[model samples]
Target: MSLSSTPPNTSTPIEDPSVYLDDPNRKSLEIDTDTHQGPALFRWLTLGMEYLIGAILVALIVSVSSNVVGRALFNHSLPWADELARMLFIWLVFIGAAAAFSRYEHIAVDALVRRLPLRLAHMLYLLQHLIITGLMMVMIWGGYQVLERSSGRSAIMNVPLSFISLSLVLCVIFIAAVSIWRMWVSLNVIRHPEGER
Candidate 1:
């Protein structure tokens, strides 16, 4: 066969985005990363949360495992272990939630969003985040109020129940900030649907 002008294995340039999108292995095009420089404190705080969550998880595993082994082998349980595991479990849950929110991976039903117009979808998305922010703010306030009465100390650890209440406050703070960030990003997308992306 006669040689064509184009070289071998040279795929045709994509004129329509749909053609490129059909490729399962195609790398995603960069969108908001170019102009989106979030706050320095937010970045550092998320990073610290990553490390803290990891440590808490590890401690939780160790405490539970050791408690199990101690009871099985020595017939004597570590009295502090049950309490330590409980506290660490709470911390782990809250920290893990914060990390998930920061990454925007929390659960949501999005079947309806896919069918909406692009502008309306962005608007609704931002509204969803605003609602979450408002709800979490109420949770944080309520948690603080109730924490005043949960002042009794843990029987084994002697740590006040208020400390556990603080975990709820911390979790909601991260979630609220992340929800706000998501809303801000959605607003930007709505305003500049063509350029910002």
Candidate 2:
């Protein structure tokens, strides 16, 4: 038999993004939530946040595209387009981050943790979530202070600056809550490893 010269195809198959968006069971979209390991409250909250993020993204696209079209075709810009797009983008980034966190979609290096004993792995997880919660708390406090000092409205849209600051506060609040829940779950697993089975 003659040896083939072709190299093997080792690339992973790419998933269709629209399939997840259109699926009724959105829970399957998440990596680790396939077995219903996440709490019900968070599942609902994540679904709602995903919808909100999608709406904000669509609005942002429309806002920016309309401005571009107006400028190109009419030689004039929509006065409010820039401000509206900015606000939507801010909300999108903050809320998208919270949603991604809930889905455990952020970049992570957990190869070592995966190989460790259950108790030790969970202990590490608890510590990690604790740090995240603490940082989120600090962000929440700082965001509130900014909101208090933000007295002016957006120049074009007449929306209060505090509205923008509120998105940051809300994002951290969701992340902090999720971190606390994860910490509790990790502590439970550490205490009763059998219960996890």
Candidate 3:
């Protein structure tokens, strides 16, 4: 076949990691060696608070279970135990969600992007964060409105519904902030001198 007429090969060899590993001349690239103390302290404090709340939740669960068991055996029911358990559960769910958001451990599907090019993958990550942050802001605003409207009402134990609603407001704000922070970190990584591969 003439050189100009030959069909081009469709397959190309993938870049070898060994090239970078074996080359001594290439300078080792370090990303984000400088620690931002404020973010680090916030992260640690948030995690510590989550752990404390988790311990309280465990204690609440154990106490509720014991009360329920004792009441069942004694043919009597504790009126406040169920309500307290429900409130504790609500607290646990919201606080747990906040913790997950802070840690970037929320559920997501990335199967389609896994096969894409690196730049596209990072772009997709940014897009996801943008959507998340927008949604969280909306939720925070809506939750605050609801809390304000329901401030005078009280739950079965005379607890204000607004108090519980405030948790939703806080959770949304925290989720949005965490999403934005993570996006900032990712952008910084992309802009680093040794850009992400």
TM-score of each: 0.76, 0.83, 0.71
> How well is each residue in 1-197 modelled by candidate 1, as lDDT tens digits?
98788778858776986542332111111112234346656666767888999889888889999999999999999999999999988888888887766644566555676556666777887888799899999998998897878969999989998998788899898888867876777777788776542
Which residue pairs collide in model 3, if any?
Answer: none
Question: Which 10 residues in a row give candidate 2 its minimum summed lDDT?
Answer: 22-31
What's the lDDT for candidate 1?
0.74
**Candidate 2 lDDT tens digits, 31-58:** 2444665777788788888999989989
Model 3's C-alpha root-mean-square deviation from the true structure amounts to 10.9
Decoy 1 TM-score against native: 0.76
Please give, for residues 1-197, the per-residue lDDT of candidate 3 as tens digits: 65777778988889997653332211111112134323764567466757868796887888698778878798777776777777777777888887766554566454565555554555566677789899998998899789879966444578888877887887788778767875675565455624644
Root mean square deviation (Cα) for candidate 2 = 6.2
- Rank order (by TM-score, best first): 2, 1, 3
Ten-residue segment with the worst summed lDDT in candidate 3? Answer: 24-33
What are the lDDT figures for the candidates, one per model? 0.74, 0.83, 0.66
The segments of candidate 3 whose C-alpha lies over 4 angstroms from its true place after superposition are: 1-38, 153-155
